[model samples]
Target: MMKLDGVVAFSMTVEAGSISQAAQRLGLAKSVVSERLAELERTLGTTLIQRTTRKLSLTASGETFLPRARRILREAQEATAELAARSGKLSGPLRISAPVGFGVLHLGPALGRFLRDYPEIDLSLELDDSFVDAASGGFDAVLRHGAVGDGRLIARRLAHSRRLLVASPAYLERHGHPGTPGALEQHRALLYSNRTSDWRFTAPGQGWSVIRPRAALRVNNGLIMRDAAIEGLGIALLPSFFIHQALAAGTLVAIDLGVQAEGAELFLTYPKDHGAAAKIRAFGDSLRRSFGSPPYWERVEPAPRAAPI
Candidate 1:
């Protein structure tokens, strides 16, 4: 039988894309991680990784062995967690990924509460807007907005996401309100760097209208785009979570109410292998209970406007 230690070392190295990163995460010396990977390769009779100074890439044989090895390691870890859970103890590090803004605004607080509730579980979180590959990133789960395209990752619905087309009221008053999505083409737009500047709209008893508007400024962060909109730079399409206060205070108004976008969904995704892990299960349950029913964050009543500085 293959050695369990060697299998786990190999999986961690591949997932982290470097022996150094794996060693850091595993709290082992670089030499030890390298030794275990070499040992595993020798036992399997194939080289798993083509290591270079810049990055590590898997060989064909390594690619073939990857999924199975990950599954084996995951199952072993889950069994250990399950045994702990049977004793009313859920203990293990749970790594999570999320977009930077949301991670700071919402997830950070939630994780603090969860950690306090489950003292045995350790938590590590990474924040970025880029799409994360859970298997490669060593994440137990990732909080993602909109739908995920990867079929291998299992997605659990966490909340409903609404996208809004908004601009500062001053900007709207300066430039007349757009009556339809088509009218946006004539206005200055603030767009996200990662996505197209297309806005979709549907009115009651009307068909879909798609608009690909021009952008005056394109930025990578949602917060930046929202700031630009607040400063009267241009109109922006952002997740409703980001603009709740502005919309509620009437600082930023939704231009065409009936012609707004819909169908953007939110999910908490994880590798299919992590489904049975106790920490993952507990956190998922906590998240569902905290935000799933009626989605309190989304249901926030419009707050009164704050005095401008």
Candidate 2:
């Protein structure tokens, strides 16, 4: 097989117009360049250049080979330039995985701004409730609710997500609000299958306690459970961010504001030891800046009075 090294050496030598010039450009010894050129000539069984005291000139055979050599060098130069640009610039496809509801409500708009700022970057986003294998799935990064278990994957806390027990005014009117956690059992509740049946609470000057409510419907999606609660289906336990708009609009009310689950968090994760992968870094930084400081996700959404229909 013809080695790219020899071809590269020949190309550089021709462009540089001397073995010494090619060596200087390539950071190789002049002797090494001369040997590679000789080997290339021997391999092709043709004398490509004639050496003179003043300057090196291409022979008849060299004239034909020169163009092809320059073409190869040009292609190689382009490839190198492309790779360097990719490494430094926030350009190319970045695959990201996130939870369905969060992606649609929060991340979607954020990504829109990110795309605007980095028009060169192409995004491949997948939102689902199921666990994702970032490495195996060729994902550049992932945003997950709660702390991750895998120590191999790297994670950065994007926000502090707090879970809340909430219900609609209409449902509370029909069922009445439970003043205590134990009182929840008397009321209908919409629960997620992924969450525990027991709900936690804390009152003024009281320690945390857990209570299991009587479920009206068990669901898998937080958005659906939230929607059901908004439409007066039942009380729902959900992350504060999911129902922020609803809560602000007076469509949903936080039932137990003084309690939370143990060790709940939200994270943006990616593979470790990835140094200066431009697209990933840009996206990660953009996320960090977007949810900067205490994190917008952790902010409590106030209940706005219902507007007249």
Candidate 3:
């Protein structure tokens, strides 16, 4: 019989794409993970994964075995969770993934409180700004802002996210604030993620408008972009949670675009096929409660607007 630990090691390594990453996710040493993978292969009498310097790929046997391995792990986890549920107590390892900025600014404190309430639950959190598939990534839940693009995941709405264009007082002071969408083209655009060379906004009477922003710097991280905007490098479009403190302190000023900027609803998503694990339900409840009925970020004072044209 294959040891569950060995199976877990192999499956986790495949999900994470590397032994080092698997070790990080599993909270085990890299050497320990490697040894377990080697031991598992020895027991199974096959080389499951093709190892290389740049990447790891699954061999024919490994590819065939991956689905079964995941199912086994899920079944074991569900069995354990079922018993914990029967005891009327939530306990077990709950792995989660979240975007970097919102996770740190908002979700981190909320999760801290949840952990306080449930001391027995061990939590592993991965903070990433890039796209992650909760099922493939081995995460029980993912806290996401914007669209939950995958249909395979069940998403529960947590709160609304508001985004807007903003810039430091110093930058606006030197360059002059943009009074219209057309005016934005005159200033430097601090592009984030896929924004690239253009920003699309809804114009009141004219409908959709595209502003081609001159970019001197582009970054994939929201926190870095927020900081860059605050440093007077350029105007940026950012979610409220990311720039609320900066806005309050008058370090960054919101530009009144006369229409909503780009944003989407916040969601806590889990694999639809996995059902509602006790931990996922528990965390989702905590998120909805802590985020408030209107969410804290929405309470920020609105920017002064020039009357409708």
Candidate 4:
């Protein structure tokens, strides 16, 4: 019988494109992964991988064996999931990937509750702002906000969040609030560096207008940009989830430019075949329950206050 561990290591290495990355994903030492792959090759009586100082390539046998090896892994997982579902018990490791801000602000608490509910399940959550490929990264699921264009993955809408233009009361007091989108050019903007285009908005009467704010400071994190705006740095266009508390507390006020900002769709995405997996289903259901129909953040409407002097 083929060793399942060796097969998994070989498959993960091929998917990740390097032994180091596979090792990191598998939570194993590089030497251990190498030894497993070598053992697998020895068992098969063939050279599976051609490794050199600079690069690693698959031998002819490795290329031919990869598809079957992947099938074996997939079948084993499906079978395990089926049995686990029948027993109504969730076990095994569930790996998840999520954006840093959302993970920190929302998923952290939600996952805590989930773990308490399913003690048998081992969960590993990776928080990163960079985009992660769910299939290749070996993640069971990924929590993301915005469009998921990958056809291979299945996306379930968790909730919706809108972007709001906001600044600290002190900042707005010092810098006059803009009455319109066009007026945003005059203000010092604290921009989120990850956004590809300019800020855009729409109103009932007005169509759509885009403004590229003169970035006084650009940061990759939404929380940092929101805090900087609160520190009286500059106006920031940020997601409501990040600013809702400040808005409610009157520390940050929304700039009513008479236009509605674009809303973002939060999704819990996973491999289509893995949808029936106990852990993925349980987590997805938990997220849907936690966020609810309108989401908890959206329920806290920002109080209206007079424009700062």
The lDDT leader among the candidates is: 4
What lDDT tens digits, residue by residue, belong to model 1 across residues 82-158?
Answer: 78766658866788888887776677667776777788887888998887886567788888887688878888887
TM-score for each candidate, following the candidate numbering: 0.71, 0.65, 0.69, 0.73
Report how far off residue 226 is in candidate 2 (Å).
0.9
Per-residue lDDT for 23-124 in model 4, tens only? 999999999999999899889999888888887899999999998998888788878876775565777788999889888888877887777777888899
lDDT of 4: 0.85
Arrange candidates, best lDDT first.
Answer: 4, 3, 1, 2
For model 3, the superposed segments whose C-alpha errors exceed 4 Å read 1-88, 194-197, 203-206, 302-309
Off by over 4 Å in 2: 1-88, 201-208, 261-264, 275-278, 297-301, 304-309
Error of 1 at 224 (Å): 1.0
lDDT of each prediction vs. the true structure? 0.80, 0.76, 0.83, 0.85
TM-score of model 1 relative to the true fold?
Answer: 0.71
The better candidate by lDDT, 1 or 3, is 3
The TM-score that candidate 2 achieves is 0.65
Return whichever of 1 and 2 wins on TM-score. 1
lDDT of 2 at 164: 77
RMSD of 3: 9.3
Better of 1 and 4 by TM-score: 4
